[model samples]
Target: MNSFTQYIQQLFANEVGGLFAAEPAPLREARQKSMDFFLAHGLPTRKMENWRQCPIDGLVQSDYRMQREADPYRPVEEYFQCQVRNLATQMFPFLNGWFVHPDAPLTKSANGVITGSVAAAVKQCPELILPYLTTTHADKADRGLVALNEALFNDGLFIYIPANVKVEEPLQLVSMINTDDNLLINNHNVIVLGENASLSFVHCDDSIKYGKTLINNVTEVHLAPNAVMHYYKTENKDADSLLVNHLFVRQQENSEWVSNVVTFNAGYIHNAIHLDLDEPFAHANLYGLYLVDKSQVVDNQVFVAHNAPDCSSYQMYKGIADDSARANFNGHIVVRQDSQRTQAYQTNRNMALTDEAVVTTHPFLEIYADDVKCSHGATVGQLNEDAMFYLRSRGIGERTARMLLMYAFANEVTDKVTIDSLRERLANMVERRLSGELTLCDQCRLHTSDGKVLIFDVDPDKI
Candidate 1:
């Protein structure tokens, strides 16, 4: 085995015993099984078909520490202050791999909704979380990183919305890595929505120290019959960090699920999303937007399974790559034999701002049902010269024209966001990123007066 795999195995060996002692028997057994699966598969390499386009060799070779400990010196509000205006939210923060609550580790709402650390929830309400823990995507065979997350994750967010309850305000979960040391953070979250329950959740991942760190995160969500869920994820990390995020969702009959992923900046980010429509009349909408520059790499992989009849799924992703940045999109839709009358659609579009920028897209549809309707397509190109000229001819400056066009392109995805405050914040952030005004200093709330702004000069030869 490689050194990285060996190191991970040793860490598990040293920590699983303590974890077993603290948890119930079923959870402990599940962790052991996950460890075995991870050991069998080891870490993925470029040779693997699913991971060929995104190589993580550098991340694996880096020296990082994996441990669960909270930093008492740092206050939660220092890292994450409320940014969305007029939106009241319950904020849950995770520093490194440990959940840092402002007062306690967990809390409950007036409507009996539970929000807190996953480890604490396991002890307080095992019955509520045990059945759904590590069980959403258990049938997938090639989920090595997911298994690793199951084996090593010590703490993350756990949210439960009881039956017939609706949360008016959104739940905000923020995870930040701010230590000076190189760290390996593995976190897993379990979210359950009971029948007729509804919730809106926003999850953010950021970095303050910008150290060489590796973050592996997994989340499982279960929606009961007639439930509704709205989920949003924002990734804004430094250039020295590597992040891998996995999200899986299972929906019952007549349920509705909507999710949006917005990536502003990162060194390397791989986002994996899976949706299983296990019952009839379920609907899912997945949307994503990414803006990357420099040598950053961003990869988004989405998989949807229509296991029941009369289910619909839609996916749309748009990205922009500048300088030597790279972006990738892979979408797969599967319509099983019993999934008749299933409708699925997927589209990925990208714009490259420089000759060295790279964008790869793959959209696949596998149908075993003859009555299913599915369509998938991808496009990669530069900004339209004709549109640029049209705007310039109308007295708009070249720089302003390019910015307006790019903003409009990205706004198409953000406009789909249902939350007014979140949509406004994202619009501002995307504009700042495209204009080169968003920098690492913004992450730490450290403002400067350098007074430098990037202006996009139209290149005639490239156009």
Candidate 2:
């Protein structure tokens, strides 16, 4: 075994006893099973087909530490106060892999909805969470990574919405890593929506300052019959971090699920999204927008399963790769034998700004039902020359014209965000990111996160 594997084994050997000491028997047993799997197979490698395009050799070779205690650093107000103004949200913050705040870790709404730490949920109501924990991991391709996360995760968010209840404010989970030493962090979250329930949630990942960290995160979402949910994720981390995220969803009869993933900044990012339509008339949509440059890497894997008749799903992902950056997209849609009249479509489009920029795209459809309607396609090229010429002929500056096209391309996905306030804030952020001028702002600390603002010589919107 390599040094990273040996280090992890030794850490588990010394800490496994106390790790599950306070948990119930089922959770403890689950962790043990996961441990066995992880010990048998280490971290994922390029040998695996699902992981060939994205390599983790650097992550496995680096030394990493696990935070064993909750150390609430002083002056929390000074460092953690950055937030989008005029955007209303119930914020749950995490620092250095542990949930932190002056308020209680768990909160209940007036309608009996519970939002809190997963550790707290395990302590308070272990029985309620048993059925949904790792229920879909049996078929996942990266079982080793999922197993490792389940075996060693520190803390995560748990959101439960009761039947017929609706939450007006969006619940935001913001996790930031701030440490000089290299570290490995795990986060496992579960969000359940009961029958006829409605909710809007936002998950944001960012870095406050310095760190060479590896974050192995997994999230499971369950939607009952007639339930409606809007889930969004915003990722903007430093260039020194590697973020791996796996999202699993199970949709029941007549349910509706929509999600938009926006990646503005990161060194290396891998996102795997899996969804199952278990009942008829259910709808699922997955949209993503990624902008990377300067040696950054972003890889996305999307799988949708239509198990019941009359179910429909759509996937649309777009990216802009510049300099020596790399981006990849793999989308697979499967229609089972009994699933008739299923409607599924997949499209991936990318723009490579330089010759060195690399892009790999694969869109596949496996159908067993003859009556189903399915189509898949992918395109990789530079921006449209005719469109650029049209803008330039209208007296728009060349730089502004190019920026406008990129913004318009990205705006297609950003416009899918459901929350009005959050959507407006994101629109502004997208514009700033395209212009590469975010540092001009002195009022918002978000300027320091990663990207810039737009000061147009001649307004392109008017043109």
Best by TM-score: 1
Question: Poorest 10 consecutive residues of model 2 by lDDT?
Answer: 439-448
In order of listing, the candidates' clash counts read: 0, 4
* Residue 106 error, candidate 2, Å: 1.8
lDDT of 2 at 266: 63
Instruction: Please write out the lDDT profile of model 1 over residues 377-432, one tens digit for every residue.
Output: 89999898999999999999999899989999999899888889788777777777
lDDT of 2 by residue, 1-463 (tens): 7787788787777666776577777777777777777777777788877788877765554488888755664435454553465568787777778777565677777888988888778877676676766353734445677888887877888899989987788888888776777878888888999999988888888875557888989989999999988889888877878888989899999999998998887678999898999999999999998888888889989999999999999888988888898898999999999999999998899989899999889898999998988988899999889999999999998999998899888888889887776776666677877777542222222222344432223222432
| C-alpha RMSD by candidate, in order | 4.8, 3.7
Query: Which residue pairs come into collision in candidate 1?
Result: none
User: Which regions of candidate 1 are displaced past 4 Å?
Assistant: 73-75, 134-141, 441-463
Whole-model lDDT for model 1 versus the true structure? 0.83
- Candidate 1 local Cα displacement, residue 192, angstroms: 0.4
